[model samples]
Each structure stands twice: as structure tokens, then as C-alpha cells.
Target: MLVVYTTTLFMISLLIIDYSTYVLEYPHSFKYNMVKNK
Candidate 1:
């Protein structure tokens, strides 16, 4: 049971980190593009 719980927690955190990276990078890329065009 403990092993299963830890594995689930690790997977959840990995997903969260991936989501955070994508979310943070998306706006940064858009902003960078806007600045470049200006």
C-alpha cells in the first residue's frame, strides 16, 4: 500500500511539473514574440 501511494504521488507531481513548465513557457514565448515584432 505504501509503495502504491508513493508512486501515485510521484506521478501526480510529475504531471504538475510538466503542466507548470508548459503553462509558464507558453506566455513567455508569446510575449517574446510580441516584443520581437515591435
Candidate 2:
């Protein structure tokens, strides 16, 4: 159970890091998509 919890947390952190990097690289497109989604 501890291993599973650690693995899930690690994956979530990696995803957050990746997403932030993407947003930093494409702020305009990200914003555009957000507006379009609405």
C-alpha cells in the first residue's frame, strides 16, 4: 500500500512538472485552448 501510494504521488508530480513545462513553452496556445474549451 505504501509503494502504491508513493508511485501514484510520483506520477502526479511528474505530470504536474510536465504540464507546467508545456504551459511555459506555449502560454498563448494553452490560453487559446482554454478559451476554446469553454
Candidate 3:
């Protein structure tokens, strides 16, 4: 039971970090595309 709880917490934290990274990277990606167009 403790193992299961710890795994769940780890997965949740991983998901949050993954989403925040994507949010940050997406803007940089968009700017890169805009620059390429010009």
C-alpha cells in the first residue's frame, strides 16, 4: 500500500513537470517558427 501511494505521487509530480516544460517550450517553438517565416 505504501509503495502504491508513493508511485502515485511520483507519477503526479512527473505529469506536472512534463506539462510545465511543454508550456514553456511551446512558446519558444512558436517564436522560432515566426522568425523562420521572416
Q: Please give the distance, in angstroms, between residue 24's alpha carbon in candidate 1 and its true position after superposition.
A: 0.8
lDDT of each: 0.99, 0.95, 1.00
RMSD of 1: 1.0
Which regions of candidate 1 are displaced past 4 Å? none
Query: What is the clash count for each candidate, in the order shown?
Result: 0, 0, 0
Clashing pairs in 1: none
Clashes of 3: 0
Better of 2 and 3 by lDDT: 3
Q: Compose the digit string of candidate 2's lDDT tens values, residues 1-38.
A: 99999999999999999999887879888888999999
Query: Residue-wise lDDT of candidate 3 within 1-38, one digit each (tens)?
Result: 99999999999999999999999999999999999999
Which of candidates 1 and 2 reaches a greater lDDT? 1
Kindly report which residue stretches of model 3 are placed more than 4 angstroms away from their true locations once superposed.
none
**Model 2 bad stretches (over 4 Å):** 28-38
How far in Å is the alpha carbon of 23 misplaced in model 1? 0.8
